[model samples]
Target: MAILSDITLYPIKSCAGIALREATLTRAGLMTEGIYDREWMVVDADGNYLTQREHPKLALVTPRIKANTLELRAPGMLRLEIPLGLPDPESAPARTVLLWDLSLKAYDCDDLTAAWFTSFLGLPCRLVRFHPEAQNLANMKWTGGVEAPTLFSDGYPVLVIGAESLRDLNERLHKAGRAPLPMNRFRPNLVVDGLGAYEEDYIDTFDFDGAVLKPVKPCPRCPMPSVDQATGTFGPDPLEILQSYRAKPEVDGGICFGMNNILLEGEGQRVHVGQQVGAELAF
Candidate 1:
C-alpha cells in the first residue's frame, strides 16, 4: 500500500522545513501551531522575495513554533522569536511585496527581526508575514482556473513526490560515482512511499482518509536543489543529470521532479505520517 512516509511543513518560504508526524491539511497548505506553510517570507529592501535560489544560506535558517511564537535559529546566530498573533490589518504596517507577478499586501515585521535576518544574511533584508486579507492564489493557468490559495510558495499550495523516485535517482547517482542526494534538496510537503518510480507524476489525487490533494502541475526543478540543506552551500549540482531524462514536454521541456498539488477536499482534515494514501491515477 502507498503510504505517507513523511510530512514536512515549511513555515518560511525557501528555508528549512520542519518535519511533523501529524499536521492539519488546510486549503492553503500544512498548518501547525496556527502557522500556515510559507506563511512568512524573507525579502530585500524593495520587498522583492529572497529565496535559497539567491541566498543559499537560507537553507540553514531553521524555524520552530512554540505556544505563541515562531522561533528561528541559524548556525552562528541567537534564536529569534516572533509573536504568532496576526496584527490588525488597519493598524499594522503594511508593504506591497513583489512575489512573482503578484504584488500583495504583507505586514512588515519589527526592526529587530529585520536586523536579525540582515545580520545573518550579510544583506539588508526583512521578514514579512502574509496579510490575513490578501488573496494570494496560485496561477490559474496551471490549476485549470481553480483559484487554489497559497502564501509565499513558489507556485502551488503543496508539492508531493514519491520516495521510490528519490531512490531511483540515488541509484543513478551511485552508478555515476556522484554522491546521493536527500529529499530535503527537493523540499516537498508530502513524500509517499510504496509507489513505483515517478508514479506520483501520473496520479490524479492523493487521498488520505477524507483529505484529498490533486496533482495539478509538474514541478520544474531549479538550481536551488544543488544547495546542500545541511551545509547551506552549493555542491555537486544534479540538474545536469536530471536534464538527460527528466524534462517534461508539457512544461516547455523544463526538467521536472515532483508534482505541484492543490487541496481539493477535506480542508480541515488532519494528515499523518504512516497513513495509507490511496492514489487515483489519471489514466
Candidate 2:
C-alpha cells in the first residue's frame, strides 16, 4: 500500500518549494490558487535562466501565497509582493529568455521586483513569468510521443521520488560518516512511501484515484543538491557518493535520483497527501 507521503509545489525554478496538503495535477505540473509550478523564473541580464546551481542563496528566497499577491521574502531583504492577476497579454512587457536550449517569451516583471532580486542576489537580473501563449513542451523522444507540457522545469512536468530511496541514501551516508540529507535536497514534486529503495526507478505509472502520472525519464543529478535549503549555502556535495552507484547508462551515465514524470490522465484532478497510490512497475 503505497501512500502519497508528500507534495511540493515550486512556483519558481530552483527556489524553495511550498509543501501542500493537496494540489491540482496538471499537464504543466502542480497548481494551487491558479499558480502553476515554475510559473515564474529569474533570469540574468542576457535573459538566461539563473538557478541555485550558480547562486545557492536562491534557496533562501521564500514565497508565500497571499490573498491577491505572491509575497516573497529573503534574508535581510524586505518583503516583495507580486500581483496574482495575469497581466494583459496585448500590452504587458515581454522579454525573450533562454531556458536551456528553448527560447521563451516571458512577461518581464516590474522594475521594483527586478531591483529586489538584483539586490538580494547581488547580480543584475530580472524575474519573468511564463507567458500565457508560450508553448513549452517536453521532448517527445523521452515521452514516447506523448505531448507533455511544462513551464520552467528542466525537462519534465513532474518529478517523483520514493521515500525509501532517500532512506537508502541516508544509510549509505551514515556509513560514510556524512550527514543525512532531507528530501528537500532532491526537490521532488511527489514523494511516495511504502516502496522498496529505488523502487520508483522501475515504476511506469502512479495511479491515483482520478489521475495517472507516468514516469518518463530519469532525472539527472546536479550540483544544486549540495545547496542546503535552510542555510542557502553549499555543503559537502553528495554527487560523488551517488556516482558510485546511482549512475545510469540510459542517461549517458548521469548520476540520477528521481523519475521525471508526465501527466497521463486526469489533468485537472486534485491529489492529496496520504492518498493511496498504485504503482505499476515497468515490464
Candidate 3:
C-alpha cells in the first residue's frame, strides 16, 4: 500500500520549507496554522518576484510559526516576526507585483520587514503577501479547462513526487560518481512511498479518504533544484543527469521531475504522514 511519507509546507515561496506531520489540504495548497503555502514572497523594487534562481541565499531565510506570528531568521540576521492575522484589505498598503506574465495585487509589507529581507538578501527588495482579494489561477490549458487556483507556486496548486523516483535517480547518480540528492532539492509538497520509480507520472488521481487530487501537468525542473536547501548555496546540478532520460516531450522537452496536481474534491481535508493513499492509474 502506498503511504504519504512526508508533508512539507512552504509558507514563503522559494524559501525554507516547514515539515509537517499533518497538514490541511486546500485548493491553493497545504496549510497549517492558517498560513497557506507560498502565501508570502519576496519581490524586487519593481515588484518582480525573486527566487533562489537569482539569489541562492534566499534558502537561508528560515521561517518558524509562533503562536500568532511567523518568525523569520537568517544567518547573521536578527529574528523578525510577522503577524499572522490578516491585515485589513482596505487599509493595508498594496502593490502591483509581476509574477510571470500576470500582474497581481499583493499587500506590501512594512518597511521593517522590507529592510529585513533587503539586508539579508543584499538586494533592494520588499516582502509581499498574497492579497485576500487577489485570485491567481493555474494554467487552464494544463488543467483541461478546470479553473484551478494557486498562490505563488510556479504554476500548479500542488506538486507530488514518488519516493522511489528519487531513489531511481540516486542510483543513477551513484553510478555517475555523484552524490545522492535529498528530497528537499525537488521541494515537493507531498511525498508518496511504496510506488515504483516515476510511478506518479501515470497516476490519474490520488484519493486521501474522500479527497481527490488530480495530477494535471509535469513539473519542469529548473536550476532552482541545484541550490542546496541546507546551505543556501549552489551545488552540483542534477539536470544533466536527468535530461538523459527524464525529459518529457509533453512539456516541450523540458526536463521534469515531480507531477503538478490540483484538488478536485474535499478542499479542507487534513492529510497526515503515514496515511494510506489510493492511487488510480491513468490507463
Candidate 4:
C-alpha cells in the first residue's frame, strides 16, 4: 500500500522547509502551528519575488517554530525570530508584490528582518508575509475549472512526488557516474512510497485520512533543483540528464518531475506520516 513517507511545509518560499510528522491539509497547502506553506516570502526592493534560481544561498536559511515565534537560522548568521501571531492588517505596513502572473498585497516586514536577509544574501531584500486580506487563486485552466487558492507558491497548492520516482532518477544518475540527489532537491510538499516510478504524473486523486488531493498539473523542472539545499551551492545540473527522457510535450517540451495538486475535500483534515494513501490513476 502507498503511504505518505514525508510531509514538508515551506513557511518561506525558496528558503527552507519544516518537516512535520503530521499537519493540517488545507486548500492553500500544508499548515502547521497556524502557519501556512509559503506564507512568508523574501522580495526585492521592487516587490519582485526572490527565489533560489537567482540567490541559491537562500536555501540555507533554516526556520524553526519556537514558542510564539518563527526562528530563522543560517550559517555564520545571527538567529532571527518573528512573532507567530498575526499582526493587525489595518495597522501593518502593506505593499503590493508580484508572483508570476498574480499581483497581490502583503505585509512588509520590519527593517531589522530586511537587514538580516540583506546581510546574508549580500543584496537588498525584504521579508514579507501574506496579508490577511489577500486572495490569490491558481489558474483554473489546469485545475479543470477548480479555483484552487495558494499562498506564495509558484503556481499550485501542493506538489506530490513518489519515492520510487527519485529512486529511478538516482539509478540513472548512478549509471551515469553522478551522485544521487535527495528528495529536498525536488521540494515536494508530499512524498509517497510504494508507487511505481513516475506514477504520480498520472495520479487522479490521493484519498487518505478523509482528505482528497487531486493532481491537477505537471510541475516543470527548473535550475533550482541543481542548487544543493544543504550547502546552498550550485553543482552538477540534472536537468540535462532529465532532458533526455522526462520532457513533457504537454508543457511545451519542458522537463517535468512532480505533480502539482489541488485540494478537493477535507479542508480541515489532519494528515499524518505513514498513513496509507489510496492513489487512483488517471488511466
Candidate 5:
C-alpha cells in the first residue's frame, strides 16, 4: 500500500515551505490552518514577483503562523506580521504584479513587511497577497482541457515524487561517493512511499481516492536546489548529479526531479499522512 510520506505547503511563492503531517487538499494546492499554498508572494519595486532564481537569499525568509496573522522571520531582520483580514479595496494599495506572462493586481503589504523582505533579499521589494479578484490559472494544455486555479505556484498545483525515486538517486550518489540527498531538495508538495523508482513520472494521474491529480509536465530543475533547506545557504549544485541520468528526452533533454501536476477532481478534500495513493499510469 502507498502512504503519503510527506506534505509541504508553500505560503509564499519561491520561498520556504511548511511541512505538515496533515493538510486540506484544495483544487489549488495544499491548505493548512486556513492558509492556501503559494497564496502570497514578494514583488519588486515594479511589482514583479521575485523568485529565488535571482535572489537565493529569499530562501531564508521563513514563515510561521500566529493567531490572526502570519509572522515572517529572516536572518538579520526584525519579525514581520501580515494580518489575515481581507483587504479593503478602497484603501488597499492595489498594484499590478507580473507572474510569468500573466499580470494581476496584488495588494501591497505594510512597510515593515516590505522593509524586512527588502533587507533580507537585498532588493527593493514588497510582500503581496493574492488578490481575490485575480485569476491565476495553470496552463489548460496540461489540465486535459479543464481549467484549474492556482496562485503564485511555478505553474502547477502539486508536485509529487516517490521515496523510492530518491532512493534510486541516492544509491547512485552513494556509489559515486557523494552524500545522499533529502526530499526537501526537490520541494515536492506530496511524497509517496512504497512505489518503484521514477514511478511518479510514469503515473498519468494520482488519485487519492477522490482527489485526482494529473502529472502534466516534467518539472525542470534549477539552481534553487543548491540552497540548503535548513540553513538557506547555497552549496554544490545537484544538476551535475541529475544530469547523468535524470534528463527527460521527452522534454527535449530537460532535467527533472518532480512532476508538475494539476488537480482534476475533489476540489476541497483533505490529504493526510499514511493515506493510500491510487495511481493511473500514462503508459
Candidate 6:
C-alpha cells in the first residue's frame, strides 16, 4: 500500500520548509499551527515574489514557531518575530501584491518586520501576508472546474511526489556517476512511498483513507530545484537528466517533477505520516 512518507510546509516561499509529522490539509495547501503554505511572501517594489532562484539568501531566512510569534532568523542577521495573531482588519496596512499576474490584496507587514527581511535578502522588499479578506483560488479549468482557495502557492494548492520516483532518478544518476539528490530538492508538499516511479503523474485522484486530492497539472521543473535546499547553493540540475525521458511533449517539452494536486474533499482533516494511500488513474 502506498503511504504518505513526508509532509513539508513552506511558511515562506523558497525558504526552509517545516517538516510535520501530521498536518491539516486545506484547500489552500498543508496547514500547520494554522499557517498555510506560502502564507507570507517577500515582494519587491513591483510586488513580484522573491525566491531562492534569484536570491539564494532567502533560504537562510529560517522560520520558527514560538508561543505567540513567527520567529525568523538569517545568518549574521538579527532575528525578527511577527505576531501569529491576525492584524486588526481595519487598521492593518493593506496593499496590492502580485503573485504572478494575480493582483490580490495583501497585508503589508510592519515596517520593522519588512526591514528585517530587506536586510536579510539584501534588497528593497517588504514582507506581506495573504490578505485575510482577499479571495485567491486555484485555476479551476485545470482542476476540472472545482474552485479551491489558496494562500500564496505558485499555482496549485498541493504538489505530490512518490519516493520511488526519486529512487528511480537516483538510480540513473548513480549509473551516470553523479551524486544522488534528496527528495527535498523536489519541494513537494506530499511525498508518498510504496509506489512505482512516475505513478503520481497518472494518478487522477489520490485517496488517503479520509481525504482526497485530484492531480491537476504536470508540475513543471524550474531553477528552484537546482538550488540546494540545505546550503542554498545552485548546482547540477535534474532537468538535464529529465530531458532525456521526463519531458512531457504535451507540455511543450518541459521536464516535469511532481504532480500539482487540488484538494477534493476533507477540509481541516489531518494527514498523518504513514497513512495508507490509494490512487485512481485518469485514463
TM-score of each model, in listed order: 0.98, 0.99, 0.99, 0.99, 0.95, 0.96
**How many residue pairs clash in each candidate at the backbone level?**
0, 0, 0, 0, 0, 0
lDDT per residue for candidate 5 within 140-227, as digits (tens), equals 8767777878888888888899999899988888887888888887889999998899888888878887888888888889888777
Instruction: State the lDDT of candidate 2 residue by residue for 50-147, as single tens digits.
Output: 99999999999999999999999999999999999999999999999999999999999999999999999999999999998888999999999999
Better of 1 and 5 by TM-score: 1
Model 6 regions lying over 4 Å from their true place: none
Q: Write the per-residue lDDT of candidate 3 for residues 72-97, one digit (tens) a residue.
A: 99999999999999999989999999
Model 6 lDDT, full chain set: 0.87
lDDT of 1 by residue, 1-283 (tens): 9999999999989889999999999889889878999999999999999999889999999999899999999999999999999998899999989898888889999999999999999999999999977788877998888979999998899999999999999999999999999999999999999999999999989998989999999999999999999999999888888999999999999999999999999998998999999999999
**Where is model 6 poorest over a 10-residue stretch in terms of lDDT?**
114-123
Please give the CA lDDT of all the candidate structures.
0.93, 0.95, 0.94, 0.94, 0.85, 0.87
* Root-mean-square deviation per candidate: 0.8, 0.6, 0.6, 0.7, 1.5, 1.2
Model 4: lowest-lDDT 10 consecutive positions: 131-140
Stretches of candidate 4 off by over 4 Å are none
Q: Residue 7 CA error for candidate 4 (Å)?
A: 0.4
Q: Which structure among the candidates has the greatest lDDT?
A: 2
Clashes of 4: 0
- Clashing residue pairs, backbone N/CA/C < 3 A, model 6: none
- Lowest-sum lDDT 10-residue window in model 3: 131-140
Worst 10 residues of 5 by lDDT: 227-236
* lDDT for each residue of candidate 6 in 1-283, tens digit (9 for 90 to 100): 8989999989988888888899999888999887889999999977888888799777777888788898988888888898999888899888998888888899889889877887777788998999878888878778778998888888889999989999999999888888999998888999999878998989989988768999888988988878887777898987888789998875788899889999888888999998888888878
lDDT of 2 at 159: 95
Q: Candidate 1: misplaced stretches above 4 Å?
A: none
